[model samples]
Target: MASGLGRGNGAAAASVQLGLWTGDAIADRFWKFYGEETSTRAITRLQFLEHVGYLLFLKLDHERAQRAGRFAQQPVAPVDAWPNLALLSGDALHTGLTTLFDELGDQQLSDRPDRQTASVVFRDAQPWDLDRMAELNKLIVEQIDPYRWLAVPQAELGRAFSRMLRDCRKEIDSKIETGQTLTPLPVLNAITKVLGVGPEDIVIDPACGTGTTLIAAYHAMLAANRQLPPAALAGADLDAQMCRLAMLNILLHTGRPFADPAPVRLADTLKRKTPVVRSGSGAVPTVAICNPPFKSNGVQPDATMRDDFWAYGDFPTNFLQHLAITLPQGARAAVFVPDGVLSGGGAAATVRQNLLRNCDVHTLLRLPTGLFHRKGVKSNVLFFTKSTPKPSGEPATRHLWVYDARTGNHHTDTGNPVTEADFDDFVASCLPEEGFAARTESKRFRRYSVAEILASPKTSLLLKAHLTKELGDFGSPKEIAFEVADRLDEAAAHFRQVAEALPGQ
Candidate 1:
């Protein structure tokens, strides 16, 4: 048992490394600065990077001004001089650094000042180079915000770094203006394994934040020798900021091939009666994947226009329902939803029932609390496929297999986070027949028939309830009953003997 438990722990650690490290590869790169004692003094990776990047820009500007003596032409203003520089405006500084880093071929500054400083100098000056400084300033304000380093709390440094890296892609794109390029490493690794997401598969992320999913999908398709079909990928977000970020993310990652009308649109999918189809072309997506916001309360829509909103009195529940409706028949979807959606009463329950009846829910990967920016909210990934009406005799779903990865798990919010390697065993467990047998214990994961699920009150498919069951160690009922009778008879005789002795006296 101890050996088995140790093996499970090892597998889980690997999954965490795979998933978290891959997703935050860029942030992870910046976080290496903390290796220097000076970097650790700051509250966050964002703060450290911003302060360092700002200092570098200042030093670089001063050097440039010194080289071009007073007798020389007027020195150009430092790109960081703009008021928005302090505000961490768009991706200018980040993109510039990314370009600088790429040119330098290293992430660190040199120990020797001259050699290190020379890496950032522009050897070839163009007639329009001064205007490029202005463009850099605009990119900083429009693409990335340095202020985010200060705005994020110390406890949420990991999330801050993730957000910063995601935003930095925009800064890179504002200068270059291209197709989706930067892909979140972790998500890309996961999507690359999907057999169905080739060039032929129509992939979409309705809530494609930063276009991470779409970019990953695009790369995965390319690797498969499938040419990216026109309109093959699409994304949408309720927040215009997210839509813009997604567009920039795609462009920066893909190296801005052409002016593709933003594959992203700003639309509230939940309340809107009509799906926001992109450009009146392209088939409905065969695959959809997203980590939708988990808000449960009444959060107002980004726009007052009610056309695309899903009108449930509650917020997140409406989004879940909306995702279900938008997925075309025979399509497959992997969505991250809060645990409340699985068990919440009233409207949420209705939605769950409708989904189970209409869709073939194959698996539920239960994620632990504190795995997200907003900690302590339980979440699950529901993998399901939409299908046409089947004959009455055919079974719609025979069993719902659940992998409980959240059990006995702990993760620090820093560089060390849960990753795909941590989920390797869980993923392995998901393999059709082989995974089912490799379970260290049946309690960790088990299957339930559809009839058993429907028989439960509220038809709640609570995986935890099914996975944990305690058994008594006592003998069988008949053996226990005989033993109890013998003890009772002995007690009665002892009482009778005491009474008889008292009467005779």
Candidate 2:
């Protein structure tokens, strides 16, 4: 837990002990207005909650500005600062929000902006009906207070608050077949560290889901003492709802809706052009970090791409390939990919070959099963950089390091939560001063020359692919048979999904 934050009490469950919330408690808050309602009601209410939260945060922020002239000369940061909104009547809040909404689009106010200025973002915007306005005000009053919300991270707080309004699984499933699962915090920390992102870099998450990766990157930049605005980081997703959520997620988490807006493009990154950013370099960047939709199966085509990713494979393979080929020279990337992308014939091999021959393919951290909400998802994070193109016939990956953190690092229950500590060694090893070149071998971490990788059957990059397994050695015959059956079932599900998406089924 973050210091000073309280964990939920088991003995005092009946008592009103505010501020302490267990993981299940948090999840319950998310499940609130979401699961049962009709789609329209669910999403609208959820969007309303986000709007109200943004307004509430701004109200608190403006209070700091008001108090600066009285007791403090400088504005206060939001870390522990609290401004009581419980006192604001429903009418007063409705009026205050209405006024701010007008100013957000006002040309005169644009000439001389203030911190409390409005932010008009795209996606499911707030509704102006009186019933919703009244409901939003009451919900805010009943659920929010200094005691309960002062320490909550905005993204987490936003999700919890919105849950009371809607989960809208149907609305979500229409966009993503897989349940929307966040990139676990441990995975987020490790990937952020490995990318070596600094203040000077322009970052992007091509498949930013609710903007978790982008928001995490924002905090990382702040930790690095970078004054970069929210616009420095960008995200793109095929879902319009997510685009809007990404915009709101960034705003609420950073407490800076007024920061110059970054483009959260609502385009399939694999198939369409990203929105133009103000950076004058269009949409490509210094660092591309993504846990893209692992299941996008569209037979998408692109003639303009400098490389033929389709000739290489399918939805996610091409998505990863797009990021690899389009990343500006010298830019860095950390991508979460399925095990299939590492090896296999046809397009997968082609894409792997291009990555090895061109990009300096460096680290491959093969993730464990059960790391995601999607059980049996065997994933990996491929960390590489797009530097100058390699010479003809020269492989860009001279030597590649692989880290296996899967076999023994299993999370079978909630109490034994996985965390960033589990990946400490891998994070430290990725340091620029002691990267793959300085790394040595271990049972969990190993290295292979480019020749070794290409010489492996089918250019398979998975380091443990060749490690032979002894059958029925650890368990009784019946137990071993069950285990083999389980493995087959998991593989069947993965391949079946792929087959369902093929052109002819």
Candidate 3:
């Protein structure tokens, strides 16, 4: 009879599975209730969903706690109401979770004989367990569809999501104070699009912040496996915490344990004693990508760093040089550096000139500001390849192509961000044949001959001044004549006044 009822109520069962109670879905129901009860108005869709998810997680956690206490024969303490957990104000859930972990340590279970037995008291007691944390983070990421919510203006929502991520990190840190990771989605997408990875290529990200670049490279290699096999991906970071996170992220996303148990290392790349080649075969990476920390100086040159063929001592410049040295001959690289590196004087200028002469310095993608989490610091991607030294008197580079996507491109933090579509024209302009055809007649993209670049005072690749010249005159002939006439009239009046004063005397 029960089986028959289940078969008959398939639609009802499906609705329950979908988290729908009667007419409205969970998200809609929460928003409707808030609209009816709350005094405040104008809540965004993302905010409403975030509020609902927080409330649901809290209730679920409480129920789980109650069940665990009953099963373990423990005294029931007063339940913490956690009323403000659903507020979506600021890091409330993160703070609450931290506090819960602290309080849980005090609870004693009669069923547990020893410390190890008591350790598994609650479902989340061992939250820092890598597998468990990854599962929880995956659940949270699934609930919060980041791609869909990317367009949402609710920074409150972003804060809530970031807080959850921080809590995940905190849990991991509590157990094994090392190996935390972060993969910024935008950067990952950019790399996969720009450099299609193959099995032959050994990819590396030296400043592998949370292993995002390495993981992304791995995925890209997998995606391109139809034509080529997967490439070996490796990374190193200065922060041990970041290395941990990178390992965890890689394990979670790839479902494959790192081939080397110590896939990540905690060592400053700029300092001496840094290893140029991997152990054993002395294999160098064929492809590299990174957004290295931009520092003017204070980078101490260590023995290993000193031996770096690309070393010039400037922090970002040194990183650029290090990448050049570590990469195989004729290997391609894409690195992000500050605007100052492109046109700065002294060592920076020398490095830039050397890079152009030694490598096939092909493309420069001028990025807009605020694309990074950091503010105000403008950046660009220098895509070049290390090549064999050209014969004397022959130009290493014949034509330098500049893509001016920076000008007229503006995006606010709370509004729309620069997307792939925004870079379509710039990408088109980069093609060898299309050249200027893909670009607009603005101070954005202009080609420079090898001779022209050599003739420049600093041999700088600063495209703005050159681009402005390409833009031609902004003032019309009539506008120029009117300005000249006005200046002449003023001078003539002053001369007449001077002559009158002298004659009268």
Pick by lDDT: which candidate is best? 2
The C-alpha TM-scores of every prediction are 0.56, 0.68, 0.55
**Higher-TM-score candidate of 2 and 3:** 2
Model 3 segments beyond 4 Å from truth? 1-192, 226-231, 258-262, 271-283, 303-305, 308-311, 393-395, 412-414, 431-443, 465-505
Segments in model 2 whose C-alpha atoms lie over 4 Å from true places: 1-122, 126-134, 141-175, 178-180, 257-259, 272-284, 304-312, 412-416, 432-436, 465-505
Error of 3 at 363 (Å): 0.7
Q: What tens digits encode model 2's per-residue C-alpha lDDT throughout 1-505? A: 2334321111222333334454335546434523433243534544544555464554445443444346432332232232433444466655655554444434343344332223324233443454445555554544443222334555555455334322432244234343244666677777877887777677888778677787767767777764675556887766655665666666655655343444465565666443222334344478888886665344455667434453546655776778777777888888888888887678888788888887898889877655654234467899888867656768877888888777655542133557778888777766636544577676667778999888988899867521434121223343345346645654777799789989983
Q: lDDT for each of the candidates? A: 0.50, 0.59, 0.50
lDDT of 1 by residue, 402-477 (tens): 7776766544234345666866665556653555444433555667676777777777866662344423223335
Lowest-lDDT window of 10 residues in candidate 2? 6-15
Could you give candidate 3's per-residue lDDT for residues 297-409 as a string of tens digits?
34346755366454355566777877765566777788887778887888778777778787777667776654543233466788777888777845566667677656655
Predicted model with the maximum TM-score: 2
Model 1 residue 348 CA deviation in Å: 0.9
Output the lDDT of residue 104, model 3.
36
The C-alpha stretches of model 1 lying farther than 4 A from their native spots are 1-195, 273-276, 299-313, 391-395, 412-415, 432-443, 465-505
- Rank by lDDT, descending? 2, 1, 3
Cα deviation in Å at residue 124, candidate 1? 33
